[model samples]
Target chain A: MRVFENWDTSLKIPSMFLLMMSMALIRDQYLISLLPCVAAILFIASGLPLSLLLSRFRAPIVFLLFVSVFLVLFSEGDALVRIGPVVLKSQGAILALNTCVRVLSVITVGIVMIYTTPLSGLSGKLKRMLIPHILVDIGIMTGRYIMVIGEDYNKMKTARKLRGYMPGKSMARRFGVIVPTAATLLIKGFQQSERVFNAMRMRGYGSSAAGEARSYALERPSISSFLMFLATVTVSVLLIVLEVTVETA
Target chain B: MHIPDGMLPGEICAAGYAGTAALTWLCIKKARSSTEDPARIVSRASVMAAAFFVVSWVHIPLPPVSVHPVLAGLMGILLGWISFPAILVGLFFQAAMFGHGGFTTLGVNALSMGGAALLAWAVYRLLNRKSGERAILISGFVAGFAGVSLAVIFTGSVLILTIPAHIDAGTEISAILAMAAAHLPLALAEGVFTALVARFLLRVKPDMLL
Candidate 1:
């Protein structure tokens, strides 16, 4: 876990993306089945808490379960089992299993990437990767402010509660309160942004020469980082090759 | 709704990415040409995105259940061409921080949600030519309702059409219709909320409505 944490974001981001894309490309049921095991091994190796992963996994897992149930019940195929006027088809079961495994594996990789990499570092890496400069800047600012605005929201909610405000059973009444609160927040945010922009302008932001000077200064990867990146690419390529071969055969 | 990874085939995902890239490029170009100060636009959009993210946590209670508003319509009316990039940023954070959405399906999710936002913005602008608070409220309601409805339809169609299942065409169409029908109530609720907020903003901070 420490090793992954210490890895450069430039290398780590692309490697994880490649790993996820490869996992997505694998379609064979057997190959797809192996992915969850691989993901488990990766999870154990990362040393992240099981509870944390499970909590992150909860929503997607519930969704997958719903999808799997629908597939098993509604999909057309030979019956594998009969239960109280319901038929479980073998093909549906296989499809469900494949879908569940594939989604879990991809999600696990994403989880690992997010947990291991710092968001600040990730944004910097994205800027270096030739993404639109304004977009990346906006992303960074948005990331910084989500927590701040969220805290403001909490305070406002608490204040409302203190003032004897409670969302009643009536939906119309609830909207009347909630919409005003949301609008107030938006106004606050807009005012704050105007101040922020003024401050940034005072600091010489949006200077064309300065912007050009800062864009896309690519850094060469360390030997270890390069080797890891190479290994990841090789694995991803191999996975695609194998899948293509199987499909063609 | 955000589609999780591995739900659709890789080809569809790839195509989604391609389409998103093109749209993002076009939006950025539009934003750059339209605004005088790039930094100000970025800052404003970022703040608005954060506010939208926080506001989405506000629960709307419907008997036996509740839902968070997507706010894509409000976003479009407020941010204009920048709404797509703002949404993309918000979705990215949602996936990274909470694992609420999918890494692989980010492009598709953005297209469904952000594309709906753009449509809503166009509708609002078109209907808002008449000057008055009533006009603003009516436009806001229509945009909000249209935004959620289009997003639901787009997401449902994509899921039903691309899902690797053996269901017949009739069943597939039925599933898509059912999904859209189930979301109608939520769309109506969003419309009312948007209209109310638009009216409030018009009274307090009239400039913010744009």
Candidate 2:
């Protein structure tokens, strides 16, 4: 856990990205299945609670199962199993398995990357990676205010509930209630933005290069971080090579 | 409609990133060249993006189920060209905060959703030449409907076309159609919601509409 947390964002971001892309590129079922095992190992190494990962896994797992069921039911191949009037094809089953493995592996890697890294470091890393400064600044502000806006919505909902506002059964009535609430939120948000812009101007934001200079300063990657990044890139290249070899065989 | 990571091929994801980078650069350039102060634009767009993100949490009951409004069209009508960057920011926060989407698929998701917003904005601007309340509501409804429908089409096409499987072409088409059919109700709901909100804003705070 400390190893990943201590790793420099410069290397960590690209390493995780390569790992995910490798998982996506692997076509052979047996080779693809190895990734989830690797992800499990990484998950355990992260030292986060098993429940946290499980909770995050719940929605995607359900979605994967739904997709897999569709593939098994609709795909064409020699019939592998008979259930009443339905036929499950061997090809469909393989496709379903491959899809599940690939999706799960990629999702697991994403979860590990997100959970292990501090988000505060993300904007900086993105900037350093040459992402647009405006996009990064907007991203930072948006991240900072999602909770604030969400809390405001909650308060408004509570106020409405206290004032005997009931969401009726009809869709029109529901829209009636929702539209006003949404309009008010937008209005407040617009007004708040003006205030925020004024405050930023007062602080000399955008008056000079200082605003750009205030971006998060990233630390240089350590030797160990570089080695890990190299290992990740090598593994990714090997996975692609093996996938191509299996395909050509 | 957020495409999860691993659902797409690495090459497709890479292409998505490439396309998104170009579009984002264009948007930033447009924003910087605008008459409005760049900082003010960013501040307003960011805060409004946050507001829209919260608004999406409002669930509309459709009997046995409920759906959240994407509000991409409303965002387009309000934020203009800044809608794309605001949406990109909003998606990033959603992916990071709740894992609702994947980091690798960010570009694809942004393009689908943000592209819809741009289309909506164009439609609204074209139809909104008339200076009447009726035109505003009608254009708003059309924009909203078009936005979500286009997003659904883009997402369905991407997912159905890109599934690394042996499913026949017939099955793929049917799957795409099925996905579109499933989201039709949500699209209609968003259309009505956007129209009503546009009308409300015009009455209370007209400038906020654009």
Candidate 3:
């Protein structure tokens, strides 16, 4: 229920910024990946469960691996190994390796930012940072209703099952029910919005936020926090410069 | 149409984000100038965003992954000018919650997915002259197909521009081709589903189609 209350929530974004910049700058291998690797471990030690982390990353990671394989197989350069006519380019293999490490690193940074800090905190941060009011509202609404409408979907599926409607028969067959289900959910959403709008009106939502909106009273980053952020950014910038110079030389 | 993180260079990704931000601002301004109240659009947009996020989770297995109906045509038909922001919010949640896409690549994904919704809406508006069921069906099908296909093209453009920097030109070309070809089935499926949803919307909630 508490929003913008994460411990040092302000610093996460800077760290993520650094992580991402370093991720893009690194060309070759695991040296740059070590930062995020250690960060991920520290995140887990700080309390995010291993399963939660895996579940968060499983699909994208699988897709990353799948695409990297294609890159390794199809790319052209000096052949490192050959099995019959299919040649694995050493360059492609390296590219794939770099791709994999970059993905893992970025994904870790994203997980740390998103999981360690609740979205409410992020929203509050965005608000403080002067994001447009409507966009911020939309972001907050998305977090709220993803859970709400997701529950509605589960209930609808269950009700359909109880009515003896068999589930999807094939990849193609599911569209029959899914379309109507989506339609139903959308219509329900519209109807639900009316009540919500009315409730907000009754609660004096519009009038007060505008009149009293300027000061949100959020926890600003401390002086030490600012120094830490500066250090992180400097390190990342230095790493990127070092890698680029090395690559060119 | 989600571009996973690190698939494109940072500059390309930055460009995607920049373009999407501009589009978002334009959409918001357009929505404001339109007849319907902006607050009402926000409420509708928010709910639709939630719907988009939910359906994305209910994926039907295709091969290495599952493909879900984007329902972009439906969003375009219903939300009018609000579809882009709605889809953007949905993609944001998708990235944050499920890691279906990455945060840094979000602009690329949003422009692909949400831009498709905006395109679908435009197509529906252009084609639905008669307001009849048959017109709705045709418009919906075309909107859906074009939405998905255009999204693939946008994705391909990003990949084409970025992947060659990391891998060989041949591999990049083939990867783009393979991705475009892979989405054909999904596009066709989306076409059918969009028509169905549009038909249902027309029959049951006629006012919503406006």
* Local distance difference test, each candidate: 0.84, 0.83, 0.73
- Residue lDDT tens for model 2, A132-164: 667777888887778888889999999999999
Q: For residues B118-191, could you state the per-residue lDDT of candidate 3 as single tens digits? A: 88888888998986889999998999888888888887867666665346566577777888898888888778
Encode model 1's per-residue lDDT on A67-106: one tens digit a residue: 7887888799899999989899888889888988899888
Candidate 1, after superposition: displacement of residue A99 in Å?
0.5
lDDT of 1 by residue, B1-210 (tens): 788877777777788888888898888888878877887778888999999999999987666788899888989988888899899989988887777778888889899999999999999999999878889989999999988999999988998888778899998888889888989988988887888888888899989876
User: Model 2 has how many clashing residue pairs?
Assistant: 0
Q: Is candidate 2 or candidate 3 better by lDDT?
A: 2
How do the candidates rank by TM-score, highest first?
1, 2, 3
- Model 3 chain B worst lDDT window (10 residues): B56-65
Model 2 / residue B57 / CA error / Å: 0.6
Please provide TM-scores, in order, for all candidate models, with all chains considered together: 0.95, 0.94, 0.89
DockQ of 1: 0.77
CAPRI quality band, candidate 2: medium
Relative to the true interface, what fraction of contacts does candidate 2 keep? Answer: 0.77
DockQ leader = 1
Candidate 1 ranges with C-alpha deviation above 4 Å: A83-85, A208-218
